[model samples]
Target: MRRVLAGLVAGALLALAGCTAESPKTDDGAAAPTGPPCLPAASAAASPGPAPSSAGKPLPAMAVRCFDGGRYVDVAQLGNAPTILNLWRSNCEPCRTELPAFQRFVTSAGSKVRVVGVIVMDSRPAAQSVIDDKQLTFPMLEDRDQQFSIALSQVVGRSVASALPATLFIAPGGRIVYTYQGIALDDEKIRALTAAHLGIEVAA
Candidate 1:
């Protein structure tokens, strides 16, 4: 009787451990992303431009690592396409709300524009969990040391490093056309902004 009880307890403990452990695979047996499986930054590289100013400008010459341990994405080199750079953090409640809207926009817009997410001042695992939970597959970069933030602030001509959920609309020439800060953006707003700033139209 004692042996059977011990065996049952051990089995229960093992089952609990199995339930509690973070699995590398999801329910469908597909390997789950340990980090944000962001797409690689655009390959078309632009020559390094002058520093950004308050007026419409290019992304500051800064390099940040892709979350998936891919190549260092040069900020200035993203001028190959019209890009939307979204800044987010895992701990921000509004970021949680707005990320899905961005995902929807990505689906609706298709290749009309480029959407990139930058996770600032957040741990890779925490950001990865959010991306997994949200099913977000946008190109993502990590600004763990806040280098991108300072560069962004310089580009926008304001101290925007600590702000969560900011969006910058950049033209193909790498000039920043608009900067949206503080508010959480939905699909309609994203579309409107894209149309207004980047001059790209999508269905209403």
Candidate 2:
């Protein structure tokens, strides 16, 4: 009986050892059954897809309507004044942040350039709130139809089609001289650019 019991115990110990040995190894070579799959470091650094504006071309002409005193005004009749057309949306954070600066530029350099706001992809009420909150003195054009955006995109470059917060610097002759997109325009930059383009000194 003693011999039989001893043999049985020995067999049990061997079986347990075999089961433990079959477990997955841990980092320290200890037994661990569950872990995430490891990936090669080089594969993690692979490049992503193409960037915005990778098409390498300008946008097509887009016609837009202007909002003037609850009436729709034609874009072509926007007058002969040197104009700064600012394309903005109500929900865009950059647009909201840069609006005050644009307002200041309009206030200080009103005589030099006419700053017009084009509301793109935004409702009238939402845009009105921005105008009221920021106290924007310039006319805010209603571009809910995206016509102006399409038109201006053609003038700048095709890459501008997918970009927002674009500004077109239209000369007195109705030609676009400067175009900026995806950036907040501050007072100093606006004043300098406008003064240079309009050929007049912007009063401090």
Candidate 3:
């Protein structure tokens, strides 16, 4: 009973903070299934599958799926700008709030920072539903097997933590300078984090 109450409290706090909950499961005790249908896309600029070679190391040489382009591409080939890779899923509660904020940040940041979205812990349809609902026009990818999440958790502290709604700040040479472990990362926090850690000042 105490454990259940603790979990409920934690969930409520996470929802308030706009963070993904831990290990969402289904009725059959399986992983949570996809959410809903993806809305019509506004542009044709999504990326394809990116299989990261090193989960927790510098930018992994991987290939991710792109929805708009309808093909796969190498993650290292995404572009040269310092990147902000955000992991999310359709079924994630906090993702409902965080993704839109990320979209706004991407639009305002322009070419100054490379912002990419990677769908985690969800089916393509469900993840697409969140994208469509949020009207996000950023680059999207997928990590269906949770390899990146495991790798990242190992790197951070050897704890098996889910990487959904997490943000990785990669420097120019693909060095991951910092990783935001919390939810509720808005434009202001993103800008401050980049400047403080990545040394790049993002203008308002």
Candidate 4:
């Protein structure tokens, strides 16, 4: 009986020692209190917030290259007109689906706003073929280097890694009034937003 009691006492002491051994240690070999690590004040302050909207302010000076009629042109000479710049590629399915609706929107938008298409990630022949096949009657800009896409992505606070079929509605003063990313743009949505923002009724 005494031996059994001794064994029990020894086992209890060993278990207690094991538990203490598992406790975290500090730099000086003292027991370290356990909780979340401390974060710097700057790190706490630097926590990301909601992304800024493109319409929040006027656009910074940007060099936009575009294809007009059958020639390449610079946006700097395009003068001050409210413009809707659409980024698309021939292989993008959403782009293909949204083109017709966009064409309709452009036709109805009239001279109040200019709708420019920037073709990216596509061969010249492929992009031209799509334009020809669709009978698109708007100014198209070739972005073989994707510079326009990168610039727009930075403006909209989005990653450049994201796919195309993006739209940016720039106000007369060069402020981005509306930015639509992903998903096919609807005719009704575009018309309503344009009318409300630009004070022009888009014909259905």
lDDT of 1: 0.78
Best by lDDT: 1
* lDDT (Cα, tens digit) per residue for candidate 2, span 2-38: 9999999999999999988885543335443121121
Summarize candidate 1's per-residue lDDT along 84-172 as a digit string, tens digits.
Answer: 88999999888899999988988887777778899999876788889989999788888878888888888789866677788999877
Candidates 2 and 3 compared by TM-score, better number: 3
Can you give the lDDT of residue 126 in candidate 2?
A: 74
Candidate numbers, best TM-score first, in rank order: 1, 3, 4, 2
Where does candidate 1 stray beyond 4 Å? 1-36, 39-55
Q: Give lDDT tens digits, candidate 4, residues 1-204.
A: 999999999999999999888866543354442222222222223212223334444554555433332233545322256667778888888888888887888677666667777788677567767777777777676666777667766776874326678777666555676677767878987787677665557789
Q: For model 4, state the Cα shift of residue 99 in Å.
A: 0.9
Please report, in order, the local distance difference test score of every candidate based on alpha carbons: 0.78, 0.62, 0.64, 0.63
Q: Which residue pairs of candidate 2 clash?
A: 57-158, 58-157, 58-158, 59-154, 59-158, 62-150, 62-151
Q: Write the per-residue lDDT of candidate 3 for residues 19-110, one digit (tens) a residue.
A: 45455543335554343212223322332222222333566666655544334556665434567878877777776778887888877877
Clash number for each model = 0, 7, 12, 0
Candidate 3 error regions (>4 Å): 1-57, 154-163
Worst 10 residues of 1 by lDDT: 45-54
Query: After best superposition, candidate 1 residue 182: deviation in angstroms?
Result: 2.5
The model with the greater TM-score, 1 or 4, is 1
RMSD of each: 9.1, 23.5, 16.6, 22.8
Q: Which candidate achieves the best TM-score against the true structure?
A: 1
